[model samples]
Target chain A: MKDFPGTPGTLTGLMLRVGQFTFAAASIAFVATGVRFQEFTAFCYLIASMGLQVLWSLWLACLDAYAMLAPRDLRNPRLVSLFVVGDWVTATLSLAAACSSAGILVLYDRDLGNCKESVCQRYQFAIAMAFMSWVLIDISSLIMFWLLAAG
Target chain B: MKDFPGTPGTLTGLMLRVGQFTFAAASIAFVATGVRFQEFTAFCYLIASMGLQVLWSLWLACLDAYAMLAPRDLRNPRLVSLFVVGDWVTATLSLAAACSSAGILVLYDRDLGNCKESVCQRYQFAIAMAFMSWVLIDISSLIMFWLLAAG
Candidate 1:
């Protein structure tokens, strides 16, 4: 299989993982700082999901950094398979969390006319960060999938 | 790769597709019959997502049936790639839709204490069906991904 920019062990891959970690962390930060985010199940779920993403991405980023420093191959079939599964699972959870949080925010802001509250903007920022995290993970998953397929 | 039960061109694959279609259709039916699902953007998003799932699954089901009747091969690499992409896209959308709808339902029923309304029950049923549909599609997508990797 032809090597791609974001293939495992590459600098691009490390950057992708860092990006995912940053966004997920930001998501959790926003939600945690917001008032009464725990009151809504969706926000809580978002926090949990983003927390997982942060951990997963941080772990992978470390691996990627080590691979870059060691200049070792990271395309072993089993390793790639593991990456694919992990990426897909995290991607799904992140997307679901973001969507659910966004749904609740929209319901409150538009339907119930509650956007005037400062917390709504915080929720929106958190959800947007979650979404950005999801997008990065989705890309990573797709690339891992393609790599596995080509292998 | 060893052949699996739910591999494309197999009876299990057909059954999975049919299951997805049935659940998605039922979700839409429940939501459509309920009062003012359009009032909330989340419910409308659920309807739209499930409607897409219904069409996608129905079309795939028909193809599966035809393959079974003809005993035709359905494991072409390109075709499997297409299936992987389609299944992944639909699965993500279905899950997001289900989660978002469920979030709204939870907010209204538990947090807001609105479960006494009959419409709440209908929405719950619809969200349940959506979740069921997502489960089937998730299975299908995973299988497709495995098949693509093995191809």
Candidate 2:
């Protein structure tokens, strides 16, 4: 086995840090700029999801360390493939959420519930799914990792 | 170094097949038996998510080939780790969603919109998130995988 100059562990650590930083910056920006009760509330939820997701990403980064340093001897190859694929899913989901959070801020600017087919309203389903799904998947994935680790 | 007995070339293919199967089965079950208009609608949504999720799982399964067949020098550790960790996240999310989906189906039976308890309401939010989320993540992950492969 080989190790990167910074160690494979640090590479993931960097990603987690950047993800957290983006989420934090977004939250601050949203609160400072967004208006309306629902928009504000959704912004808060978005922040909450981002916060949780960063932690989730970090946790998986650590697991990557484990998989490299100490993958189970009798691991299922199919499961390993599944694990990698799911990581992409979560990261893309996170990115979707980041874009949606921006969209949410836009919706707040326009107050789209009072309007229709506005950019925010048009993709609100995707935007809303972005944040809400992040939370749901984050919590669920955390549980799954714990189980896999324990098992 | 080692390959699984049967590795699917594209999780994309599997996801499509699973989506189709889930839709057909869920739809047939609903139509052949009986369901309220609202249940039918929710079922429709569930079927969409469920089918997509099947593809997501297959995608992860397919990634195993990269892990097994790629030349050692050409393999990128960071990229490989990303693939494996993603598989873990998606699988976990699927398991969590399977649990949540079952719960939501029950709530759907009881009428989710009318619920008043804060916890129940939260679960409603959580389940709705689960349904849309797994599917969204599935599609987004595939796109990202393609972009990375293309880039």
Question: What TM-score, to 2 decimals, does candidate 2 have?
Answer: 0.34
Going through the candidates in order, what is the number of backbone clashes in each?
Answer: 0, 19
Model 1 chain B lowest lDDT segment of ten: B110-119
What is the C-alpha lDDT profile of model 2 across A1-151, one tens digit per residue? 2222222234443344344445444443444343442433334545554555556556655655665566432134455345445644564445444443443334334433444444344334434444444454443343333323333
lDDT against the true structure, each candidate:
0.89, 0.42
What's the iRMSD of model 1? 2.0
Question: In model 2, how large is the Cα lDDT of residue B109?
Answer: 39
Q: How well is candidate 1 docked (DockQ)?
A: 0.61
The TM-score values for the models, in the order shown, are 0.90, 0.34
- Which ten-residue region of model 2 chain B has the weakest summed lDDT? B1-10
Which candidate should be chosen as best, given TM-score against the real structure? 1
